[model samples]
Target: MSKPPATILASVKQTASVIFLHGLGDVGASWLEAFNTYRIPKAVPHVKFIFPNAPIQRVTLNMGMPMPTWFDIHGLDQNAKEDQPGIEKSSKYLSDLIEEEIKGGISPERIMVGGFSMGGAVAIHAALTSPHTLGGVLALSTWLPLSTTFPKALISGDKKVNLPILQCHGDQDSMVQVQWARLTEQGIKAMGFKQYTFKEYRNMEHSSCNEEMEDVSKFIVQNLPKVD
Candidate 1:
């Protein structure tokens, strides 16, 4: 079993949940700390927060240096070889987290899954493949992996195909370049996904900015509001 995720319990009656995943070489604690630094928790005290860590493994992009990675990356190129199996494995873990929430009494519709960069890539995959329809998907500084296999690999009749997706990226990101995000935008459009929002930050790099964080907080609230 994986390590228990860092969590923030809701202040009021819990009705919704958000799971935020970190990027390569990151741990759930760091992400949770950063999240606490913001007003996200206060913004929605009724929403439970979860930060899960990816497993540590060798990364080819970093010359095989071991790091906490959701999946292996052969390279950063848009067309580089992707670790499909690894991605699927990580996606299952995320889905299992969602299952945990559902089993704990939170409805599937009240749950949101999200992540940054590589983690965001897996979020997109897992959200698209889940048998249940979630509240939304939050993908930051990331591109769609296995882009070609999409729409086909996506579940045939799952409501996740129409799942709300908020994809944010830095226009000046040299790592997961803005071009890659644009391609993902085009792909999402081709797939006819409803409720998809793509936000590009000006003068931003691979990292996030205050404006992006503000948008993220709003997205969470918008997707997972208080239930009656």
Candidate 2:
């Protein structure tokens, strides 16, 4: 499959790039509003933002109804069986996006991958399996899918990812329970993933908040490559 068309916010010089994936049911264009709503363009003017749309697919948890999802969610249980094939496919697509950015002149270390909810799950998977160490990864309001196999996958990779990771979740997230996010943190840490930060927002739910956006902006600024 070809790379999905993206909604891009180009920087003046395009020194760095962020490939952000939207959650299920969302189109890439919707994140343009998010960028403006959060004033991300103003905060990080040197970095480009790329939001890619997921291919429409049937989700089992959604009663097999079709939706734009990176992978199918069979069940919401913590240990529910994951859609490994779907995740791998999406991860490869994400890697292709990263490679494209690299080809466009951004260094692999200057590119970050991130997403929300289901998108975040794929972002984590891509980052873990990528041969090149990236700027970082942002997993927001997301849990670790295929948790049992992720550690082995990381170990089998050609290089270990030492980049910083910023994981944020809502304390009141009913869709992806905060407990599951904590478990994901524990799982990654057990695999010796250093430089991971887990931030919890009070009174928030299964969505992004102003405070979270502010923190994300800070993370972007911190991790972006410094122009010499």
Each model's lDDT comes to 0.89, 0.86
TM-score for every candidate vs. truth? 0.96, 0.94
Error of 2 at 90 (Å): 0.5
Best by TM-score: 1
Query: C-alpha displacement of 88 in model 1, angstroms?
Result: 0.5
Off by over 4 Å in 1: 156-158
Model 2, C-alpha of 76: deviation from truth (Å): 0.6
Count of residue pairs whose backbone atoms collide, per candidate: 0, 0
Worst 10 residues of 2 by lDDT: 154-163
Clash count for candidate 1 is 0
Instruction: Give the alpha carbon lDDT tens digit for every residue of 10-92 in model 2.
Output: 55677899999999888877876787788887777778888888998999999999988898888877767789999999999
lDDT of model 2 at residue 175? Answer: 90
